[model samples]
Structures are given as C-alpha cells and as structure tokens.
Target: EFYTQPVQSSVTQLGADIYTGDNCALNTGSGKREVVVPVKFQFEFATLPKVALNFDQIDCTDATNQTRIGVQPRNITTKGFDCVFYTWNENKVYSLRADYIPTAE
Candidate 1:
C-alpha cells in the first residue's frame, strides 16, 4: 500500500526582485528575466522532494507578442527550495503558483 501527504503550494509575482538590471531589458519586446521565489516547506522531509509550477495569470503590454514563460526548481533542500520563474519576449506576469510533494521513491 502507498500513502501520500498533503501538497504544499505558494504563489509569487514575476518581474520582481533580481528580474531587473541587465538580466532584463526594460520596455523591450525581446527580454529574458529570471525571478527566484523562495519556498518553505510546511513539513520537512528526509529526502529532497519534487516541485511543479503553473501559470495562474499572465499580463503583458504587447498583446500581439507571443510571450514565453517557464519555471524550475533551484537550490533544492529537504526543507525547501527556490522556484525560478523565467520569461522571454514578455513584459510582465501577474501570478504563478507552485506545488511540491515529498517522496524519495
């Protein structure tokens, strides 16, 4: 038999913190920025867990522009990790949601 625990989740904003400077071009059609949002686990696990991200809401200045967005896990630890939200050719992002689960198997 297998058992699972409750999933931990969080929401973060884009184009904020570390997304400025040379990493991103202001008021430009072509730009790439990476924003790191720190996430803390509700319950610590013995081993590193897995995480997932999804776009809840996205806002951009250029309606005609095809924006690109992505998310990944960084600095993974048993306690928590940072969720990196990245985008290219986009102006802004409203919100992003992240979910995590702890499982060694």
Candidate 2:
C-alpha cells in the first residue's frame, strides 16, 4: 500500500508561498496518473509565524500493480517529490512519498 492508516494530510505556507503535502500518486493508470491533492495548513493563534502540513494516511490507488508516489508543491517551479513502491496482493496500496521545498522570501 502507498498510504498510511487514518489518511489525512496538511500543508502550511511560509510567507513565500512554500506549499507542501505528504502524498503524491503517479503512473498507476492507463497512462501517467500523477495526482497532487492540495491540503490545508495547520495554523494557530499566537503562534510565531510558522506553519506545518499534516497528511492523514490514505491509500494511493493505482490501476497497475506498480506505481510512484510523493508530494508536489506549486510554489516550487518544476520541482516535485517522487518514489517507487511495489504492490502487495489483496491489500490497499499506499506510499510515504511527499515533497517540500523552502525558498527565501
């Protein structure tokens, strides 16, 4: 499986539009099945200008037994996170692939 238990994820922004996520699905269909689901960030009051992303575990379903997974942020042009994951029979697929890139403001 390419997902973790209790699938949930979040991405926090850092002044410079530093977006992020904890999951990315790719190449699991008739063609390239790259999917980047945007997640909301966890922000709190009185917090010192910082943000974080959290992903609740979820299956990264693919039409093929083999697949690639990770996270992608639009903030970083031409950048993404990717990883290969093998499938297990009779079980939901999931991957811990995630992407993150910090830029100077």
- Over 4 Å off, model 1: 1-30, 61-63
Per-model C-alpha lDDT, please?
0.56, 0.34
Root-mean-square deviation of each candidate, in angstroms? 8.0, 15.2
User: For all candidates, what are the clash counts?
Assistant: 0, 21
Worst 10 residues of 1 by lDDT: 12-21
Model 1, span 1-105: residue lDDT tens? 999998975432222222222323333445786667787766676666655545544444546666667767788787777878776664565444444443442
What TM-score does each of the candidates earn?
0.58, 0.27
RMSD versus native structure for model 1:
8.0
Measured by lDDT, the strongest candidate is: 1
Alpha-carbon error at 64 in model 1, in Å? 3.5
Indicate the TM-score of model 2.
0.27
The residue-by-residue lDDT of candidate 2 on 1-105, one tens digit each, is 596688554433432222223332332324334444343333332322222233334455544565433333443222222222333333233434333322222
